[model samples]
Target: MSPYLLIQLAALGLYLFLVAVNWSALPEPMAVHFDASGDPNGFMSQAWGAVGIPLMVWAMFFGLTVLGRDPGFFARMKRFSPSGWRAWAEFNTLMGLGLLTVSSMTVLYNVEAIPGEWIGYSVWIFLAFAFLAIYRLASVGR
Candidate 1:
């Protein structure tokens, strides 16, 4: 596996580990949504709140990996630039990690393990990663 793929797997593993380790301690109704100021404004079933986000994150990256394997998936991009699948992997890894960070923070926040305000910080971090991913994607095939 490329280092980028490994990093993506690591992110998936970390997200799962966090959810599993904290599952029992989480409230039945978790505070899953927060406002601009980081206060919880919405709630959900603990199972879904804890598991849904991470699963979605992993699934999205996994889909990207699968798409990369399709015969014609990278052909067009490869024609324009040789980086090909590696570039996709890099983008996938970053977006996955950024999402994982935010998801993990929300899970932790629900347990009162983290301050309410840190969710915003995690969101900011995700946005930074997102912008970097955009630049990387746009630069591909250049």
Candidate 2:
């Protein structure tokens, strides 16, 4: 496997490990059962977890496949010379920053629901996508 694939797998493993370690501490339900549903942040946190976890997995696996097929991915990224790059950067920034913030805040607010185990998985997934977004955004080499 390529070094990049190794890194991706390792990250995935590490995240799973953390989630297992903290499983017992996390909240039982992982959601607002009653009136708490009105809490926007709380709702957002749950939404992030539901959406972010899958997104992270998709991005890492997809990105790995993409980069693997084109080992010169970095070169290609750096070669971008178009106004579209700005739009790409903005899109990624919005996605990465938005998801990262929501995920982080969810972990913070729902400490019970987000024990070390869940937190690890949720966060690592968020980070994976966030990393991809950041990389893509930052790759515009003028």
- Which candidate number has the best TM-score? 1
Model 2 lDDT, full chain set: 0.46
The 10 consecutive residues of candidate 2 with the worst lDDT sum are 32-41
Candidate 2, which segments miss by more than 4 Å at Cα? Answer: 29-40, 43-142
Candidate 2 lDDT, tens digit per residue, 90-117?
A: 4433453444444444444456443334
**What does candidate 1 score on TM?**
0.87
Query: Scored by CA lDDT, what does every candidate get?
Result: 0.79, 0.46
Instruction: Candidate 2: give the clashing pairs.
Output: 19-117, 22-117, 27-112, 27-113
- 49-70 in candidate 1: lDDT tens per residue? 8887667766788678667756
Candidate closest to the true structure, highest lDDT: 1
